[model samples]
Target: MGILDAKALRDDIVARLLTDEVDLETSAYLDRILELAEMEEAEHQFLNDPFDRSVALVLQLFQDKDLDPWAVDLSAFLEMFSTRIEDTEDIDLPTCGRLIRMAWQVLRGQAETLIERQNHEDEVDEPWIYDGGWESDFDDNDYNFSVGIITGTHKERLPDMFSGRIQREEGRPVTLGELLMGLKAASRISEEQNLRLKIAEKRRASLEMARERFSGSLHVEDLEGDIRRTWEAMRMRANPEDQTCTLSAISEELADRSMESGTIREEANAEAQVAAMVATLFLVNRGYASIEQKDAIDGSVILTDLHPDESDFEELSLRLHPPPEIEEAV
Candidate 1:
């Protein structure tokens, strides 16, 4: 498809994503899954294997703790944290109790960062951020580098938190050749699920209600109201209007609420977490109010409102709809 067509399709999907709170929540879940999906086989075995699950959990905890990415010594860390038990029929490891300890200690009291250890800092130190040379055309001097499907972010701060070379189907976290692959495959299925809605209405009353709700007559009121409505529709216990929220926070809130209501709190899988992030990103980019994540740890995508005086909408108005440049007179 053409760029414009793809953009239009993306807009359509995004609009649908906005309308349904489930979509928002699911997208957030998917984002995390994509991050975990750094491993090519991670997703397939995640649900089935405990070791893979443990690794994903460890990775998430590492991220949530805001520990150094390069600090991770996967083999050593796994050795230290794994639960050493005799292999059972259900869970098959190489030998005795070689499995990830579910509740391994990560955070220290009043510590600014995740951990105090510097096990593998030297391994991460390299002049060029990228391990493999995918982009033949890229040079050392260019400020920003794009290699085919992937784009590098932390050029100035090489081998830092989010700096790396990659080509992913969708952008989420850094994935090396043998790491995360944040592939996002959605759209047709979502549309197919919604097909029944096109003709479900036996009465026009719902249409009238929708029209009344979305008159789109007022400017400021409409914008403010939309934001408020989105906040409401999410139905989160704590308001993220002015404060930052995280996947963990939302999970805790939802779990508590569910328990209080005597409903079982089902875990939000990797896909759901990743899906929820889409909504968060959408709100950050388009929601009139500016926001930021409370911390590097815990809240990955949930943003706290910044309430900037001037915004992209204000600054880009002229550029977006510029009058035709006056031609030079002959």
Candidate 2:
């Protein structure tokens, strides 16, 4: 009559077949055969105009017959027809029909084989009994899932199933120091951290050298100059301000010196000049040669016999005056 009516009639026939019941009605038998033929036509139409809903219906029909709806051998089907399947916008009608036919063949063959097996079993008088679970029959001596065998002395042992050969070669045990050294060498400390540690060590060494050089016996002028320059250098490197107190202490020492007021003034001037020169040298050594000379020389030299108006010593220069030539002996 129509596709749905034909499908319903075919479904009823298949249901009866599954339950081993038969209907002798000629109208039903004719409808069932006609439905199979109609399905073949529908399958071809599906191939040409694939639709998801239609493909799902065809898939269900094939599955009802216990057949894989995509019945072509996987490799051959993929090579020859997969692109068509993907390109189609409707269900694959031809493939569905082929799948239905294959399912019927397979089911029929299986049924025949099962019938043969049952007939043979019926002839057996004293059938052997099979234990329900294979595992339950196993004894302790049988291969166990839990326990595994280990071989050799505990110190040199390996799993029994391990394929590698074990040797009894004698050797002295590793010493504690050697083991510790190996571990230390393999530790995670980075090269950059090590480099920083080295730099810190060098800076400490340089500071110690400076302390030793400055602490030795020095003329008051030389001592004051060195301490001031050292303080400035430390400051440039962002060293602690506590180091600057060393220079202050040296200044205090110079201030404490007992001398004529004139001599004390002259010595302070000489000390300031020397300090400026030391500071200039320190800056030069540290690669700041372009540092302003005016700043370096400020208040760094002593002047005598100047007017009262020139008493402010802030602007004095530290440039060394050349030694005057001695008069030839008359």
Candidate 3:
């Protein structure tokens, strides 16, 4: 398809993404459109168009939610911090942990600033401040020299960070690549820190929820039969070789069966959907089945007895958005 047609389709899909809260299938459709553009040798024309820039940013945001393009290293950060102190023995667990947390937040802020700069280059009308913490007494030359060293362009002539006002030049803003150096440093420091916080937060929530009482009417006794039925249904319908089935397929299949059996009068009520998900949870916890959700970005889930150990596994949280119920005919 031509770029115009592609852009129209992309816009429609993006609208759905915004309204529907990031449907992975719709995002995948956008991916396919991009691939088509690449195949037709019009990728540059498609991306460089001023009107399509917003679409590109939206697509990129969904594609890379974490957005840590620069690799962060915690050990190097700690070592560098310790070098500033004369007594390395004073470095303790609490101190190191605190520093790690602080560094993580700082990097996150820097990355956010870089992203804002990229998304709104025209709107940023002022000279961006560098938070490098170099002594304020240092001349513009010193700051520029430090930036060059950090960005690995010390040998090459670099632009003055304060060309506009410091040097009394007419108008010269800092380069995007220069701001990107901050991003890269932030990325490096965030690699270890990001995972540490996420794991800790999620684990805390998972444990807390496990201890808390379920306020819902779905009792354990109520789901005993349903859980078995759900498991058996999965075992039967799952691909014989892979023992896998999409979550949507299994849920819909069970819903249809329940409707036929008169267990549910209407088509897939919210109660019935919740029960299905709860039953699936029971099956997974009991080792009768395992879930395969490679990433939340894809938003595709599969029920499988064949557990893939290499894939990153995230604990299931109760985030279900059932489709709108079908209206009854008069």
Candidate 4:
């Protein structure tokens, strides 16, 4: 989407190169991707040669690497990526040019997906306690926080779901980041609740229908009519503008669209989490652009100075009882 910077991508691949420890297969694929990237960026029509068909398979591999490749089917993708190339030999210069362009598009999409997923996964869902001790409570448990946005721990949804939870418990001033974090959490929780309610209603209706079948009084036409009426009701409720999808699923969709941006969500001890949230708010309202959690256990925050021109007098004023006034040097 962005200017298709193939040279930059090629350089990036070269820098990483990847190790076989992860997956020899994926590593080899990377090698092929990098090779094709270099040739394509160099504007070489070398794919027209007798062995150029293999290059076509490599190019197809890029195209088949889309988000929902299963829709295209593995056999179909295999044929397109590898076998389909066997049919073409001594391809024309124009075709070679098209293949080069297509290869760039495919590889770029795959790279964008990698970057997008990594960015989402890295979101700062900070530890609820030091050294991940919170894991002990919910290690094998799954949470259904408002539904679709289920996290392994409430920590994922809490800061985002309820700001008051953070404020009341943490008892500290909240930060803009913390507020945004809570809004995002709340939005996710709301979406999940909607999904859950819809799913529950559907299941309940199915159960009622199953019970009705046991009564054995309904004719086929009657059953059809009932189904049709339900269908009509669903159609009436379906709004094209309604976007009540799971937040992570929405995130995955955005990734497929080749764009990316997100934020970290934090949830500590309700008190600890809320305290950190409030502490963050304190710094944010004071013209601090950001607050970094240095020690959540101790409710410490670094109010990032967005305006370096200003002094730390505000920061100093927040300080009190410093080393007991150094005993006034006695």
lDDT of every predicted structure (CA atoms) = 0.35, 0.37, 0.47, 0.37
Top-scoring candidate (TM-score): 3
Score residue 34 of candidate 3 by CA lDDT: 56
Candidate 3's C-alpha runs over 4 A off are: 1-221, 263-269, 306-330
TM-score of 4: 0.20
How big is the positional error of residue 64 in model 3, measured in Å on the Cα after superposition? 39
lDDT by residue for model 4 (1-330), tens? 111132333222222222223332345455555455556543333443423334443445446544321111222222232332324332132343455355445545644554554554455243232243322344222344434355454556556554443343435667546767766986787677676666656655654553443233111223323322222222233233441122122222323322222322211111122122233344345443344443332222233434333344334334521345344565
How far residue 320's Cα lies from its native spot in candidate 2, in Å, is 27
Ranking by TM-score: 3, 1, 4, 2
lDDT of 3 by residue, 116-151 (tens): 544543333343335654223578897887888788
Residue-wise lDDT of candidate 2 within 1-330, one digit each (tens)? 433343333333233222223442433333533444466454433343222223223333444444432221222222223333334333233343454344344444444544554555444334234345432456775344324333223423234424443332344455445545655764534444566556656655654553453333123535434634433333433223222222223232443342334445444533433343344344335332322212232211211111122322222212222357799999
> In model 4, which runs have C-alpha deviations exceeding 4 angstroms?
1-48, 66-92, 130-330
The pairs that clash in candidate 3 are: 71-188, 72-188, 72-189, 73-188
Badly placed stretches (over 4 Å) of model 2 are: 1-153, 158-185, 188-199, 208-266, 272-330
1 or 3, greater by lDDT: 3
> Where is model 1 poorest over a 10-residue stretch in terms of lDDT?
2-11
